[model samples]
Target: MNKVFNTRYLVHLVLAGLFSFLVFNLTYAVRPSDYDLKEGDTTSASGSDDPDVYIINEHGYKRLFLNPVIFNFYGHLGGFAKVKAISPSTRDAFITSGLFRNCEANDEKVYGLESTGEDTSILHWINTTGAQAVIDDPNFFKKVFCINNNEFNWYLKGSDYNSVNQIPVYSRDTTSTSTVRVGIIEFVPQNVVYGDVHYAYLKKTSGCWLSSGGEIGNYYWVSGSNQSIHSSDCYDILETYSFLDIFNNLSKGISKNVQRTIYGEEDTMETLHSVYYIKDFYEKEALKYGVSDLAIDIDVKGPYMLASDPPLGGRWGVGEGVCNASLTEFFVNEAISRGVDESQYDVIAYVYLGDWQLSGRSYEGFTSCATGSKSFMTVTTWRLPQEDEGVVTLAHELGHSFGASDYYTSPCPQNPTLWSCVKDPEGIPEPNKIPKYPQTKGCLMAQIIAYNKPGSDEAGDATSISNLNQAVICDATAREFGWR
Candidate 1:
């Protein structure tokens, strides 16, 4: 009886072991297909030839996993799948696929996970902290998932994707109107962009006319004439006079030191004029207006010859006087070549040795004619004038550059009828009026030529007389220039 019982017990033990083995095989077979995947085999979870380790749900719309997950999961196994490591470029492609839907109806969220070779055990914590955390915190989503256009293939927040190559795929707002949309992703064109080119040229003329009595008055033939209009030849008179002589004569009587009280404080300022001598009239005038400060400083340049033949008009033609435009171009070019910074000088004064003409009349001088606020060039014919007329002319022209207009009443050569109707036609109320006129009578802008009649105060050797009183800027003129 003991031997039979022992044999029975051994058979029962064998049967029990077989039954346990069958049950284990059945359980393994019935398990999910994804769980049965081997290290070397690919899983249908990601639809790639990489072992799947984690399942990612796209807001209940689609489920997928990254390719690198397989290599990262079974890295310790000798037969683990051989896959490339995840890169920024690959990660961008996954984000741009548009397979992931918005996690919330009104909220757009994106999340990304990077693998650590040490162990995927931390992946289990993803349920409580990974994608859900990104969805909860918009800042975290932007920091980790969103990237600039230059860094990724898609446009994220603040990414400039408005070019033709990159087209926007997302709406700017949660509205039905497509008017506001995000930029798209495209390659930047390899081409250069250019801006508009600006070119300017001065007007050309054979000759210019100078009016004796301002813009509108008695006309005298200065240039392109054989006979002299004044007692002394205009050319000879201009050649004999010197700017230093004129400066010394004009500066006489006027105090170099000035005192003023501003903001309850007495301030004294000394004005100094540093004069520089040049060889020719053009250089002198150029340096005067170019280097000489409006309030101080004076310098001389060269007696350089004309760059090219002067653009003069035909003999006895309407354009027989000096072309102010041509002279301006010539002087400007010379200053540029001499290494003189044109920008340094706020004003340009052209002192011609001979009389020039403008607007069909002969004149001693003119200022701010051709170019208005731009480098206000004062063209003065250095001919001998009666009394302190030369000095007055110089002061008057310079005044025009300093926002003073001619106060004289003269009809516009082009529109005589209209100008004649107005009370000081030459004095336009505008700030930078071309051929500005004076608002007051007997002011410098009104009459630069001094008179020495019996009743005139501007008498004597003319050189000794100071025209400061006549040429001083008026209150209206000062107001126009914003000098209250």
Candidate 2:
């Protein structure tokens, strides 16, 4: 009887050991918490009384876990089943609050026997602590970091609790709108300078008109009686005949700077029909010279109204102003039809003071475009004989299209007494000191080139006209519009 009893006791002990091994393995396979259910979501489990406990936290997560009864009694019954719910915001708070730093903390063991490996032990610790954390604060177990309670308090206290670790947001009025915007247009001329208030020299400068070979040639008789309409054409003629010829004859000017055969040729067509075909080509060329990548097509509905009553106030006069306004409007309408939205383009009428007021100051060219209008428009004015001044006038007017400020100082009392605008120590600037307008010379607004002055230091420097400088002009314009 004693032998039989001892044998039965040994069998019972063996069975108990088997049960312990099975339960430990089963727990290892239990699913963890999910934290991705949305607010107001309900989840159901195999044996849960309430299926509405699942909720997603701010960070969006969900998890599954063994039900309490299954966690305890399932091992006794040799069954494995669990409940599931969305992780809550408390987990996020734990991480943000510095409760646990990394996976190492999550791997700690809390209630269960600690595993030998550090990672496994910590995971076990966190699994148990997570449940307790939820009990302490229903939303506390949202993140893995929150599984460790001691670390959270320690971080907050050490950081003074006032240090904001997250980005803050501010609100602005969202419904505000404006019906109208304002704009302005101005010009720069040849051979101007910019300086500081203390007369500390800032820069010597040249205007766009001067740099582009404008106002450098004699007037051409289109009809041998009619004057040339385009100012640039006249400048080109002078560049070809007067400057190039003289320079070429003296000291290899032809090879050194003129590039006569390659650079000095004009359009070969003598007939009006031929000229018309290439009109757009010429205009496009001019636009490129102005440093704009976006080209404007020439709309020559008719010849520039140079023959109108009272000579149409050539270039920037009041009559020219009216004409410019009309042209700008026409182009603006076309752009709008081609899918450009309102306010995308501004049109300004550039009017020189002499032209608008009929001051008979023909040499003092004038032009204006509508202020703040994205579409460019200008009625430029020049002398009665505009042929010789094409380059200067055209470049001056185009400068406004690129948003350059005027370097010319008006006698107005309210103007800023800034050093760069006017009053240079060297008696007005000659030659462009800075290549780009802003922070360089007086800007395109001053519209003056170095050669215009007698005996200027930079008088012979053609390097200013290099393609690099041209590129700068194009670059600056592109930058203003946030383009390449």
Candidate 3:
């Protein structure tokens, strides 16, 4: 009987120990600290006036706390508020507090607070303190915070913050053309950094512009057109000109037969014919829209020889195949020396020393604009043409001078897959910010060859002027040249 009692007692002791272990493990798993409050969870609050405060992550994910006391720092907030990322390394977490208030018409204060290490842990806090928040942090809190008071208002008007950094806030005066606005919000890194910043002016029932629901980065509340603050008025017509540079190799004799053979014609007046051909082409194309009376007076010069000390690429060296900026400059200087006025002409075409039949290649053309008002266009050819390709090439180069964009796809620094020759992704379009036409296959902007192959027998007929299929200038190009 004594042994049986001892065995029963030992078994009971073992059972009791197991029960205690299970209870401890279960309690730990459901502890208050272990519970993560995701977006949209309603919890009781301690300091929050609304008794409901939500957690907004860097990516703008919102969650309601299971226990409001966990995030006691968040309270009833009015005015503008946002969250942004503080550090680039930990973009997923470590958000900065972005809060601001417009107390009066001439007084405002911006506040920024950020967590150091972890999101829920809240290891350290960095706060923007003082009369006005300094634009000294790597976060968006400094960038977006502002007061609407006179002093703060003066700062917004005087400072060009958008020129240096990306700010998401737009003005409450929707009709106003100003680019900047005043507000304060937390720095939620991911929200502030990567995508397009959007903002909208809500027409409140009170007939006031309500700058509410402010965000750091892209938000659905902001409309696309509202995001664009400035657009230039493109209504002025450009006075354009064409300067032709005809190259004659000094080594070759200036015989009628040589000129005829080089120009692909039996006429002795090769230069005259070429000039007339270009003038007629421009007149026919430009007169259709009445953009400007096409004035292309051509001056053909140069039976000049290449310099012995060719700078680079052996260009203009006896018979070497080369084309570059240096060569283009050399040709431009030659044209000027031959009495072609620089101010008179906006476009230049250069025909150089090589046979199109033997080389069958043309150097691409470009435009340069120093004053930002008008483009100086230039095209260069290594050899004279024996086919319609010469006229096509010349027209293509002049197109650049006239603010026409190229449709061909080429690798660029901004976009590696493909980039337009005319439109820059970084800033507004040159000449005007007119929308570029959709790239059409085999169009004049896309290629130099005539699409319909009209006037196959005539020289200079492969251009847009003669070929109906190749003659279409996109609406954007038309607007850029003030044709529309």
- Sliding window of 10 residues with minimal summed lDDT for model 3: 178-187
The C-alpha stretches of model 3 lying farther than 4 A from their native spots are: 1-275, 309-325, 336-343, 356-389, 411-442, 448-469
Q: In model 1, how large is the Cα lDDT of residue 347?
A: 40
Scored against the true structure, residue 276 in model 1 reaches a CA lDDT of: 19
RMSD of each: 36.9, 31.4, 30.3
Per residue, candidate 1 scores C-alpha lDDT tens digits across 161-272 of: 1111111121111112101011110111112111111111112112322322222211121222223222232222222223223333333311122222323322221211
Q: Encode model 3's per-residue lDDT on 1-484: one tens digit a residue.
A: 0000111212212322221100011100122223343332323333323333344432222232223233333333321133321221111121222333344543333422222222221111122233112222223343233223432222212222211111211111111121111011001111111111122222221322224432222111221222232111211112111112221222111112111122233222112123324444443343233222234455444434433322334233322323445655655575565555545433344543332222333322233211111222222232222122344445454555445656544433344533222222211112222333222222345443332222233343222222222333444544444444
Candidate 1 — number of clashing residue pairs? 35
Give the winner by lDDT: 1 or 2. Answer: 1
| Model 3: lDDT of residue 119 | 28
Best-first order by lDDT: 3, 1, 2
lDDT against the true structure, per candidate, is 0.27, 0.25, 0.29
Error of 2 at 289 (Å): 14
Judged by lDDT relative to the true structure, which candidate is superior, 1 or 3?
3
- What does candidate 3 score on TM? 0.28
